[model samples]
Target: MKLLRWTPLALALLAGAGTASAQDKPDPNLARNLAATCAGCHGTGGRTVPGSAVEPLAGADSAVLMQKLRDFRSGARPATIMHQISKGYTEAQLELIAAYFAARK
Candidate 1:
């Protein structure tokens, strides 16, 4: 009788545990991590050194960034390497990257 009563409670707890663990946790630093890949050319915090030919991304408008990235991804923009590079990121990742840079000063 004791086992029978506890079995239901145990099963319920196990099921709840599985459900909780199964839910995916979004990374808090995903945008930063993704944007880190651009630091080489764009510079840290999206701010390039003065007089650098590569345009600074810091403080750029998100709409413009999105349009530019989308263009590069779609091959509509003529870039020696951006087109190829942008191809590697998913649409959502691209959005995150653009937003991340847009937020930086």
Candidate 2:
């Protein structure tokens, strides 16, 4: 019957959706992912990047980092690279990434 065939397909889709939602955890690996993107310029874990002017970020103050991020996102801070990347990221993701790095020590 048409109804029976559709019912199985609908159930399979629902099951797949539920599994995906379960996998969407808060991302404790925030530091790892963020570091990968930043390491090219900022160095890993606050180490100074070779031949780069960017400052270290591993043990920076959380408040300071948060403020800087806000500034970058709002055009208050004048950074070419950060402004571009930060613009596309959500506030929550920014906070998580900032906190992950700030709490490194």
Score every model by TM-score: 0.77, 0.77
What does each candidate score in C-alpha RMSD?
Answer: 5.0, 2.6
Q: How does each model score on lDDT?
A: 0.92, 0.79
Range of the 10 consecutive residues with the lowest summed lDDT in candidate 2: 43-52
Off by over 4 Å in 2: 20-24
TM-score of 1: 0.77
State the TM-score for model 2: 0.77
lDDT of candidate model 1 versus the reference: 0.92
Candidate 2 residue-wise lDDT, 1-105, digit = tens: 899979989999999999999788766676568656777777777567557689878888878888998898889999978888877778887777777778776
Q: Can you write out model 1's per-residue Cα lDDT over 1-105, one digit (the tens) per residue?
A: 999989999999999998888667778899999999999999998999999999999999988998999998898988988998898999999999999999988
Best by lDDT: 1
Instruction: Show model 1 residue runs off by greater than 4 Å.
Output: 1-23
Evaluate residue 59 in candidate 1 and report its C-alpha lDDT on the 0 to 100 scale. 91
